[model samples]
Target: MAQPIIEFKNFGFQYDAQAEPTLYNIDLAIQPGERVLIAGPSGSGKSTIASCINGLIPFSYPGRCTGSLTVDGVDAPNASIFELSKHVGTVLQDPDGQFIGLTVGEDIAFALENQCVAQPEMKQTVERVARLVDVENLLEQEPHALSGGQKQRVSLAGVMVDDVKVLLFDEPLANLDPAAGKQTIELIDQVQQKTGATVIIIEHRLEDVLWRSVDRIVLMGEGRILADTTPEALLAGNQLAENGIREPLYITALKYAGVSLEAEKKPAHVDTLRLTEQDKAAVRTWYQQTVARPQAPAAAPLLEVKDLCFGYSEGVTNLRDVSFTLNEGDMVSIVGRNGAGKSTLAKLICGFETPRSGSVWLNGRNLEGDTIKERAAHIGYVMQNPNQMISQSLIFDEVALGLRTAKLPEDEVERRVNEALTICGLYPFRKWPVSALSFGQKKRVTIASVLVMQPKVLILDEPTAGQDFRHYTEIMEFLRSLNQKGYTVIMVTHDMHLMLEYTSRALVFNQSRMIGDLTPAELLCDSTLVEQAALKETSLFTLAQKCGIQPPEAFVQHFIDYDREVRDKWQTV
Candidate 1:
C-alpha cells in the first residue's frame, strides 16, 4: 500500500446540538490518488464523513471531536475550513447552495477570486475546467435553469477550478435521472483517469456508481465502518439487507433464480453465464419453471383523466388527449424521456395546470374549477426540486405549516410535525435551520412536510431525485404505508427501479401522448414501447435477454414482496 493522503485515528464526533455522536471510533486511511466510495443506508453519517474532510464537521458544524482526522497531511483538529478548502474541493449534493456566481463562469471562479488569483489567469482556468466538465456552452447561463445533471457537473467544475488535490462529492447522483446519473458517474471516471485526483464519492446510488473504475467500497452502518471491501465482494456478502439498503438488481435476480454465491464457485458476472447455446437453454429452463409472475392489482379506478389536451404556451402541446386511471390503493409511477409530459399530467391532476380541452376526475368528481386549495384536501403534491417548495427555516415549523393553516391546536401541530419529522428521519434536526441542513436532508424535510398533511392521495414529483440509498428506501417505505392504507399514490419519475418495486401500474409518456398504462413487466418486455417513451430496461431485465429468456414474472413479484417486507419493517412504532 502507498502512503495514505488521509487518515482517521480513533475519530469520533457529535454535533453540538445532537444527543449522540454521529460517527463513532472511526478509523480509516486513503492512499494518494485513490478513488473511494463511502456508502451506506440513510443516517449512517456518510455526509458527515465528507464534512470532516472539508473541515465542516469540527468547525462549521460546531461539533465535539475525539482523536484526529487528517487530510492532505494536516490534522483536522487544528486546521481551519479555509485551510482545508485549498486541498479538498467539495461539490455538495445541492448545487443551488454551491453556486455563488450569477453566471456559470462567475460561479466557477468565486473560490479562485477569493484566493487573489490574477483576473486574466482566472478567466483561463475557469474556462478550462468548465469545458472539461462539458459545460462550456452554459458558461453564460444562470445556474438555476440547468437540469439536475448539468447543475451537478457545474458544481464539480467550480470545485475543480481551484486545482485541489482531493475531490469530495456528497451524493452526486441524488437528483439526476438514470441516464444523467450514469453520465455523471462516467464523467467522474474520465476525470479521475485524466487527473488521478484522490476522489472520494459519498453516495447511495451504488448500483450505478460501483463501476470498475472505483477501487473500493466503504460501507457504513449504525455509526460504524462495517465493511471496506471491493464492490463485488460486498454484493456477494449477506449483510447488505440488514443495513436496510437495496442490493443491486443483478445480484437479486440471480438469488431469485436459486443461485447462491458459494455454489457459483468464485465466478464473476461474466463467468456465470457461458456463451454456449446449450448452457443458455438450461438457465432459461430454470427461470421458466421457478419464477411466478404477479398479477396486476384488481380494483376500480381511483383517478381518471379524459381527453386531457393541455399546453401552457402557444403551439407547444404538453399533454394531448391524455387518458388514464389510477386505481384505489395503487402505487403507479410514470416513466418517460425528458419533457415527456410526466410532470404535466401531475400538474394537471394537482390543479396547478389546467387542461385546454379535457377533464381530470378524482374519485368521480371533476377537478375542473376546483381551487388548488380544494384539490389540496386530497392530493399532497411535492415538486421535483425541494427548493421550490421550501419556505420555512426551522424544520418543525415547515412541517407544521399546513396544520397551522387548518387552525389546529398548538399541541396537535407539534404532534403531527414530530411524527412527520421522525418518519422522514429528520426528527433529530427538527429545530435546525433548513439552510444549515444538507441537500439530501432538505429533500427529506420536504417529504415530511407533505406526509404531515395526511392527504388521501400523494403525488410526489421526482422525490428520490437527489437521494442516497437510505433516503431512497425511507421514502419508498413511507409511500408503501400510505398505499397500504388505501391512498392512491402516484409518482412522476424517470427512475425505473422505483417503478419496479412500488408501482402497481406503469404509465408511459412520449410525444405528448399517454402511450400505454401497463405493468412494469409489460413495459420492460416491450422494448419498442420503452424506446418510444424514452425509457431504458432494468439491467436485470436486459440480462435476462442475454440469458436467452424473456423476463420472468417471478422476478417482478419477488421485487414487490421484498419492497413490502422493507416497508413493513420501517414503519413508525
Candidate 2:
C-alpha cells in the first residue's frame, strides 16, 4: 500500500476572530498519485481544508489549528508557506486574486524566478508549462486583460510550472464555459497521469468534475466530512440531496422515475450505467406522463436594441450590429464562450457603454441620451464580480444605498430593503458586516441592492456563480416570482442547467455576434449550435440518449417541461 501524500487526523481549524471552528475534526488520507474531489455547498469548510493543505490557514488566515495535518509528509501548521510551496501548488478560486505578473509568461515564470533558476531554464520551463496548458499563444498578452476562462488557464500554467507532488484546484470550473470546463477536466486528468501528482479538486460542479474518473470524493458539510467514498457508492444513495448538494440531473431523473440502483456496483457514468428493461420502461413512462405547459403570448417589447455597434478602441470591436428585443415578463438567457461579448451586450443595454452608431429604446424612451444613473431607473445590472459592485460595510446599508440615493422616503427605503433582503435569503445577515460574509453571501448583497431599486429590467451576470444549490434555487425562484409579476429578467451565464431550467429564450453569441436566438431547448438540441456556441450537451440529454430513446431532443424537452411543472407546484404549495 502507498503512503498517504495528504492526511488529516482529528484535525480542527477555527479563525482567530470567530467564536466557532470552521472545520470540525476531520480524518482523511489521500495516497500518492490519487485524485480526490473535495465537494460541498457554500460555507461548508471545504475551502478551509484546501487552505490548510496549502499552508494558508496558519500562515495567512491567522487560524487556530488542532490535531495533525500533513502534505507530502510535511507538517502543515508548522511549515512555512514557502516550504509547503515546494510540494503543493494551489490554484485559487479567484484566478485574478492569484495573479501578480503583468503578462502570462511572466506569471508562469514567477515561481521559477523565486527559486533563482537561470533565465534560460526559467524560460524553458515557462514555455513547456504554457504548452501543457495550451496557453502558448497568450504568453505575451497581459494576464488581467484576458477573459475569465483564459485567466483560469494562465493560473493553471503558473502552478504547473513547478514540479510539485500535490496540486490543489479551488472551484476551477466556476467561471468556465461548458466546453472549456470539459477541456479543463480532461487537462487535469492528463496532468495527473504525466506527473503522478496527488490532485485534489475543490468544486461544486460535481458532474463536470465527474467527467474524469476520481479515486474518491470527500464530501463536506459545516466543516466535517460527510462521506468519503467512490462516486458510484455516493450517488447510489440520497445522501448528496439530503445534504443540500446537487445530484447529477440524470441521477435525479432516474430517481423521479422510481428506478433503484442499490444492487448495482458499477460506476455512475451515464455511458456505463446499464438499466434494466423495467428501468427503461419506467423512464419512458415518466416521459409519457409529462404534459407540456401552454406558452403565454409575449407582452410588447420592454427593451429594444437596433443596429448597435461598440468598440473599446479603434479596430477593436466588442459588439457589432447587434439587435435584439426583450419583452416584458420574459425570462431570457445570454450564453457563449468567455470573451464572446455577452457581458459587453449587457453593459450596452444598461447604458454603461456608449454605442458607436446605434440606439437603445426602453419603453419608447431613448437610452442613448440617459446617464448611467438615469438609466438605473429602468435597468439594473448586477456585475459578474460581486466585489466590484459591493460598496457599503453593512449588508442592510448596502441594500438600502440605491433606494436612499433615489431620495425615497426613509420608511419606503426600509421596507424595500427588507423585502429585497428577504427575497435574496439574506435577511438574517442584514445586520452582519459585509467583510465577514462569504463570497456567495456578498453576491446576494449586491443582488439585494439592485432588487431594492425595482428596475423594470434586471440584468444579472452569472448570478448563481458562487452560490450553493439551496441559494441557487432560492434566487431563481425569486426571479421566477418577479417574472410572474411582469418584470423582465435577463441573465448572462454559463450554467446550462440555469439556462434550460429557468429561461424560456436564449440568445447565443460568438465572436461579438449573435449566432442563434431560440428557446433553450432548441439551442441544446441542435448539435451544431451547441458546438458553435461552445456549449456542452446537458447530462440529461446524454441520459436520454443512453436510454435508447428515439429523438433524444423530445425527451429533453419533456424533462424540462416536467421540471417546470414540479417547480411551479412547489411554489404554489
Please give each candidate's TM-score: 0.81, 0.94
lDDT by residue (1-573, candidate 1, tens digit) is 776889998999898898999999999999988899898877788888889889987787888889888888888768998888888999887788888889999999998889899999999999899888899999999998787788888999988976788999888876666667777888888888777899999877677776435778888987889988766677777767678666777666666555555413332243343344554554465555533335556878778889999888999898899887777788888888667788888888888887899898887988897999788878889887788999988888888998898899999999889988887778989989999987667777887888888776888888677565566766677677767767788899877788887786788888789899888877866778867875655666655666766454544554556545545556634
Please list the residue runs of candidate 1 whose C-alpha ends up more than 4 Å from where it truly belongs after superposition: 262-286, 289-298, 309-321, 337-339, 363-365, 382-456, 463-478, 510-516, 525-536, 551-573
lDDT at 532, model 1: 85
Query: Over all chains combined, what TM-score does candidate 2 have?
Result: 0.94
Model 2 lDDT-worst window of ten: 262-271
The lDDT values for all models are 0.78, 0.87
Worst 10 residues of 1 by lDDT: 262-271
Query: Candidate 1 lDDT (Cα, whole model)?
Result: 0.78
lDDT of 2 by residue, 1-573 (tens): 877998899999999988999999999999999999988888899989999999888888997899999888899999999999889999887799989888999999999888899999999999998887778999999998887667878988888877899989999988889988888888889878877888999988888899999989889998899999988999898889988888888888888788887627343577677788888889988888948687778589789989889999999989888888888888999999888899999989888888898899999878888999989877988887789988888999989998888899999998999998897788888899999987767777887787788889999999888677887887788778777877789999999999988998999998888888898877887889898888988777777876778677778778888878877887789
lDDT of 1 at 505: 78
- Model 2 clash pairs? none
How many residue pairs clash (N, CA or C atoms closer than 3 angstroms) in each of the candidate models, in the order given? 6, 0
